[model samples]
Target: MARAVELATVLGSDRVDQALGLAATAGRFADDDLVSILEHIAASKPVGEIVRADEAHSVQSGTIVWQALGQQPTAARESTGD
Candidate 1:
């Protein structure tokens, strides 16, 4: 709860606080769900771009998002470093 509150504070947005409140109450969630949530929050790009045949753009966008989350890479940090 404290960690969620702290993260909500850092985010400094009512939307984030509300979402965190929900998550904290609901307890843990799956990694893919979390990633999907993050993608929504960051508005990285449309799902089409992510699933496009051009692997380079998809890889680049993924890299940008992974780095934003303090991760090395999805494959490297799939366990969430927990």
Candidate 2:
């Protein structure tokens, strides 16, 4: 829960929405759970310094937390073969 809030704080609404969708579609969580997380996100404000210092860390840690809660792996980005 705390992890999710921290994640939403750093990553903002769009990415958090994506995470929620992934979790829901994976059957890991229900609509109520997603709503609760979204509420937390809506109530949160990002601390600029903290966000700057640990955005990547927040995302990584949040990924682990979400996976533990049964979130599906996101689709890998296709390389352009550059």
Clashes of each: 0, 0
Residues 14-80, candidate 2, lDDT per residue (tens digit)? 8676668767676757556666666665576752534444655553544545544654344523343
* Model 2 lDDT, residue 58, Cα: 56
Worst 10 residues of 1 by lDDT: 30-39
Q: Estimate each model's TM-score.
A: 0.28, 0.31
Models, CA RMSD each:
19.1, 19.3
Off by over 4 Å in 1: 21-39, 44-82
* 70 Cα displacement, candidate 1 (Å): 58
lDDT of each: 0.55, 0.61
Output the lDDT of residue 79, model 2.
43
Over 1-82, each residue of candidate 1 has an lDDT whose tens digit, in order, gives 4544554567655646545545566674554444345446667554356454575555454555554575476767777777
Task: Report clash pairs, candidate 1.
Answer: none
Q: Cα deviation of 58 in candidate 2 (Å)?
A: 37
**Candidate with maximal lDDT:** 2
